[model samples]
Target: MAGIDLSLKEMMAIDGALGAAVVDYSSGMALGTLGGSKELDLAVASAGNTEVVRGKMRTIEQLNLKEGIDDILITLTRQYHIIMPLTGRKGGGLFLYLALDRERANLALARHRLKAVEEAIAV
Candidate 1:
């Protein structure tokens, strides 16, 4: 991993954070999660977003972009969902999923911070 600890705690450190997970996109299963709630299940959200990642990858292949995604942003009325695919040898099928409270979050800062975390994460 990039940091001493490549865990959800690092992600939840961001302002207006909700939940975060290290997920396996191929299987749509969260390897770990933090800040999950009854109203917003991280597992389900992770799975759903896994499909979103797959769709985007498929589209990229069809378009022959021949590049990897930096991040996927979904802006909602109250929330911002960020899906960032991991890179490196073992990073092939992994991603970081972060959910933030839009009103309290600084989107630009969040993206910057997320990128930092992504770089630190090993696999």
Candidate 2:
């Protein structure tokens, strides 16, 4: 296994983590997943989130922004959804998706940890 393959496991260790997945934005596919309850279909969420990443990428291009997206955070009444695109040379067009319980999550720490996880993912 790639040294970075443990990313999903590390993500699950985060406080309040409800679900986590590595996504292929170009294909709308969840490469790997952990923690989502049955009622919370990770497959569907991963597919839907592809659009979110695409929309943001489009917006940045249209604005001619020089900066790439570090992450995108969606705050719901009870959940926090984070979308982070990967930066690895072999991992273009991929992202890390995390769902957290707002009441129990430390958003700043979770973001920090997610960044770390992104750096470690090999593909």
Give the winner by TM-score: 2
Candidate 1 residue-wise lDDT, 40-122, digit = tens: 79999999999999999999999999799999999998999999998777577999999999988999999899888887886
TM-score of each: 0.93, 0.94
Cα deviation at 57, candidate 2, in Å, is 0.5
Q: For candidate 1, what is the total of clashing residue pairs?
A: 4
Q: Which candidate is the best by lDDT?
A: 2
Return the TM-score for candidate 1, rounded to 2 decimals. Answer: 0.93
For candidate 2, write residues 3-114 as lDDT tens digits.
Answer: 3348999998999999999999999999999989986689999999999999999999999999888999999999999999987585679999999999999999999999
